[model samples]
Target chain A: EAGVVQSPRYKIIEKKQPVAFWCNPISGHNTLYWYLQNLGQGPELLIRYENEEAVDDSQLPKDRFSAERLKGVDSTLKIQPAELGDSAVYLCASSRTVYNEQFFGPGTRLTVL
Target chain B: SQQGEEDPQALSIQEGENATMNCSYKTSINNLQWYRQNSGRGLVHLILIRSNEREKHSGRLRVTLDTSKKSSSLLITASRAADTASYFCATDSGATNKLIFGTGTLLAVQP
Candidate 1:
């Protein structure tokens, strides 16, 4: 069984530039999530998708951050005009359902200079 | 503020020794999970304990939860060099479908 997959393992962009990370969750998983982990800290949820519908996204910064799971299989997280504080690891995870254990993807490390 | 907080930010032990880490959280949760991460890669699920359950074991790993104190602990017996990594505890709060992770504990098992 293949694990969660993510692209662009590492990304470096200057402040005010835009960056986007992609994630493909495990097959047959119905719940997808996006999280941000800063240095020395744990992951914080940015958004959650239950079959292409965003069920929870309160923590996402509406002004600059956006995420979409078009078919509920793959997801994309975008940050426009990124700030230095946005530098962190972007993690994608998926579960069979809301209460199931999540499987994570190797995160995309974003560095905003 | 994170819902889960882990204690003993760092630990070091010999290969044959045991390593334990603790986690505390606020509010009620449906379940708690343990994960291991090597370097900056993805996390591997180690174990999960539901709220009603007190203790769970898998292979050489053990996890215990105390609902009254809103705390949990992970124990790895006879640790090996491959166990050198960061361990984290995540909570599944009742309201949200998301899991909030704790500040990890860095474990260095010397061979």
Candidate 2:
């Protein structure tokens, strides 16, 4: 079976522009997560999805960032009017159950100039 | 929010030596997991230790969790240059399935 997959491993856009990243979790995994990783720092949870419902999005920047897990199998994270601070690696991961070990994707490296 | 803190912001060791990193977390956790990240790319899950379990091993990796102290340790035996990377410890805290991660420890193995 394939591991989690992410698109556009590298992305560059100007500040105030819109950027989107895509992720496809592993098959049969019910829990999906999005995280932002800054230089020399660990990944921080942006949002979490349990199937089609987003159970937690407290860490997400609701004003400029929005995410969807349409069918729960795949998810997309969009940042409108992106800011310079948004330049970081966006990682997607999935697990078979809540609190279980997670598998991660290569991640989308976004550079906002 | 960040939940755990890893000590020894950086570690340098010769190949074939052992590397050990420690992590301390706040609040109770159902499980603790260790992950490795190369550069700024994605993270690879190394091992997971449940709250009830004290230790776990996989290949060259060994993880020990002590709920009494709310701390965990990861030991990599017979390390190789390929082991150079950033290691992190994460915890499952709330009911949202969200994982809180620590600052991380950078390990550089000299061949």
After superposition of all CA atoms, the RMSD between model 2 and the true structure is 1.5
Calculate DockQ per candidate and list them: 0.82, 0.73
Residue-level lDDT of model 2, residues A1-113, one tens digit each, is 99999998999999999999999999999999999999878899899899999988889999999999998799999999999999999999999987567899999999999
Model 1 Cα lDDT, one tens digit per residue, A19-68:
99999999999999898999888888999999999999999999999999
TM-score of chain A of each: 0.98, 0.98
What is the alpha-carbon lDDT of model 1 when measured against the actual structure? 0.92
RMSD of each: 1.1, 1.5
Give the per-residue lDDT of model 1 (tens digit) for B1-111: 588889899999999999999999998999999999987556889999999999999999999999999999999999999999999999987786578899999999999
TM-score of chain B of 1: 0.96
Worst 10 residues of 1 chain B by lDDT: B92-101
**CAPRI verdict (incorrect, acceptable, medium, high) for model 1:** high
Q: CA lDDT, every prediction?
A: 0.92, 0.92
Give the fraction of reference interface contacts each candidate recovers.
Answer: 0.94, 0.89
> How well is each residue in B16-111 modelled by candidate 2, as lDDT tens digits?
999999999999988899999885555898888888999999999999999999999999999999999999999976554568899999999999
My TM-score estimates for the predictions, one after another, are 0.97, 0.95
